[model samples]
Target: MSDPHATSPEDVDLSRFDAIVDVRPQAQTRPHLPESTFTPLERLLEDPAASLPSTSARVLVVCDIGMRSAIAARELAELGYQSVTSLDGGIDAWRRHGLPLAGTDSLTPNELERFDRQIKIPDIGSTGQSKLRSASVTVIGAGGLGSPVISYLAGAGIGTLRIVDPDVVELSNLQRQPIYALSDLGRPKVAAAADSVAATTTQTATEIVQGSFDSSSAADLIEGSTVVVDATDSFQARYDLSDATRKAEVPLVTGAVYRWEGQITTLVPNGACYRCIFPSPPESAARLDCALVGAVGPVVGTIGTLQATEVIRISAGLAPAYAGRLLMYDGAVGTFSSVSVQARPDCVCQRP
Candidate 1:
């Protein structure tokens, strides 16, 4: 018969324990069993009664492997505790049994393996990964800038990606928009972008809107989005997105590329919005189009990658890096620079 004071991880009825305590070091106690209280093995060894609940309580002790918890359980038993048990193989064995962990229960085994590298990061732990899986980001274009943004965000495991674009792919787009191919020519940009994202990862759901993003449709397009990305090539669309995001109180990652230069910035609600940098759209006559000035593929890619980074960071519960600042890249010179931005007192963002 098994020792009454020891139980296998697979056989333990967690609900029966009045107190489930983790006896590992504080740092090693992450991803522990649900509802478990932390009491390091060293502390329990120092003062068993002081480190635990009432001796009469039904307690379950756990550690990384079975060693620490077994020792802890023996100490508790020697102290005349009414009932106590140790997890046979500890948390490692429990994990091997495919049991649920406290902060990562929602993530599937595939997701844990897919995002393992990032999850190891102290700041972007399992909690941040969960946030990424719950976030929705709406990208307003699927061309040069939107291609990389959609691709990376999908790879990063964004839960939902809503793509809005009215244009169709063409031969000219292949020069910069790597998300599409010759076979995708004449296909709607949104549809093609969604296919690219689908090929990247199944974790993110894609929402395709085969329509232009204008003032009339901006709000409806961005509704329920955790973040918005402005990747359109027109000043008019930028102005509309700036106004719409500000009004909706959503964060916007806006970027632009012209020739060999590109600039990116993140606009958070109540912060310096796009309009704070450009109070109004420039005159049509003065505006330069990518078709006219010609865009460099890497230039747009650089900005798009940065925009994707901002969205992932924001979705993961981190502060926006470029909020109230403009980050500019000059590919021709291989240089980067930033300038501080402030909201205009009379700007629409500052109004009620």
Candidate 2:
């Protein structure tokens, strides 16, 4: 006789169950059935009440090859789960039956584990994680602002990072640009940034563009990129990147720091561009370089971290936080403020 407590993949109708539970090991449980809850068999066996919903709910348990799920179903039934069933062949059979799975199939079991905590977020679940795994971001500079931006993005599992910089690491850069060490002094910033990203996560691929980001090179550097980050120190480079990304219809996250103050914003195609805010570069006397006036390391780090978050949000298909506004931070007072901004009618960004 066949087991009444088990159902085959052909008989499964996901809508009928209040909860579909995966009882496989955590590492093997990703890319599971859509909207399925993951409660490893070990955890479920130890405490069914804590691991799952009410026992009266219609539940379906699945595993790798069906054995564990079958055992779990029987145990749950004995524990007074009114309606529970196991997948007769588990995920293996579901796969054979050509059913849909959620995460990216390209991710290995190890990659799943490495990103387990991030993948657990409801908003950034396996689907969002997959998007991140396929995203490519082009960072315009590898200095203070780029340091935290690159580090955090790599940690967040961004698929590809293209770092562009024309300068070499100097002793003064070590204050805010943590991606390099003393030994790296005099080495190209792009190369050092690539090595830093590699150390953070092997899953991310790094492309080092050892050149400046200007109108001539901006198009090619940001081609095929999901987003472009403006971590440049000069207003000229920022304006160039903003125009390039706007023309290409790609999103751009731009940030700046001076002394203990910093600001960041995101610009999307057809929306407000950088010129909408500044209109033109500040006069040479007004423009302050960190090297000339000095900057607080944490101030740049703070702005860079926020810029990275914006990049991740855009890459994962979420709304940009600072799309048409500027977020400013005052490290001296430990306060943050935001100002609304709009597209300039007379600026090139508004031209057809």
Candidate 3:
């Protein structure tokens, strides 16, 4: 029999449910079933901190074989629930018992059409889409890397974009930066990028700051921006962004792409600042700009895409997340690796 007491992970405290399903019948079933929605241990660990059915939760655990379900139920015992029981015959039993599956009729007509794609995803539905639409992001450059960053940020429905770049477009930028066309050759990077936002995603308001973004400008931008994407290529620019965003305690999604190499790192206040990672400028600086060197189209695309993903996730309230971690990508080999970030004890602390 299904228990009347069902506790979800969102229910912070137990004492919510009155009945719990017994999983004795689950043990007799097979290990796996074709139609089961039950999540495997590996899948659960992949999203580490996602709330699951707590053993103390009064949830009616469904399993193909009640045996495994009961076993999994015990995993939530320490969560302070009173029950983590399973169905008598699992989902099969629930079916035989004539329990009705929830219907989609609860959705409004427009909602059903608007969120058709999101509704299909398990965790992200209308709720997540709304969160995404209301997200605010700040892009710390409107040049090469920022081009893709701004385009995708707008396409993603970021409610607002604050672009910080003091440069203008030039003929040399045509090779890699496509956000600006030849007609926009002389326009400031921020102005041209803002125009792109209006043309594509009018819903996202673009604010262009014509001045350079130093420690002071960074503070104002970080104040209301939920996420900051560092598309700046220069080491000095990256360091300034790191120090300033860290001081403002904003999450910084920093990315840089050269010929075929790219790197991304997400930083918060206590995160390892770029200063901590690249403690001092290289003995001899590598002033390699595509104008001087060259770059592949997809290289910046891949890196900027990663930065966009991090920003969306930060705005979406995800946890067990990326902070103080550097992710490096090599488009040539198509390999990606990551390492943890740490504070530099020898470095001077700079505030926003």
Highest-lDDT candidate = 1
User: What TM-score against the true fold does each predicted structure earn?
Assistant: 0.78, 0.76, 0.65
Q: Mind giving the per-residue lDDT tens digits that candidate 1 earns over 240-282?
A: 9988998899999999988898999998887888778888766
Instruction: Report the Cα lDDT for residue 213, model 3.
Output: 71
TM-score of 3: 0.65
RMSD of model 3, in Å?
A: 10.0
Candidate 2 shows a clash count of 0
Give the per-residue lDDT digits (tens) of candidate 3, residues 1-352: 4433332223212234433332322222222222233445444334413534443345544554354455555554443456554444454444344343222323344444544554445444444545666777888878778888888768766678988888888888877788899999888988888988899855689888877777666678667777788887677777788877777778888876667887788878765788877888775335335555577877887887777777766775664255767788888888999889887777665433
- Which window of 10 residues has the lowest lDDT sum in candidate 1? 280-289
lDDT (0 to 1) per candidate = 0.87, 0.87, 0.64
Q: Order of candidates by lDDT, top first?
A: 1, 2, 3
lDDT of 1 at 7: 92
Give the per-residue Cα lDDT of candidate 1 at 274.
Answer: 78
lDDT of candidate 2 over 1-352, digit per residue (tens) = 6788999999999999999888876623256777788888889988988867898989999987789999999999998998999989887788678787665556666766788787766567667788898999999899999999999999999999999999999999999988899989999999888988887788899999898888998889999999999998888788888888999999999998989899999998967998888886767524447878889999999999999999999988789999889999999999999998899899887777
Better of 2 and 3 by TM-score: 2
Q: What is the lDDT, from 0 to 100, of the residue 284 in candidate 2? A: 57
In model 3, what is the error at residue 194, expressed in angstroms?
Answer: 1.8
lDDT, candidate 3, residue 236?
74
Ranking by TM-score: 1, 2, 3
Which number leads on TM-score?
Answer: 1
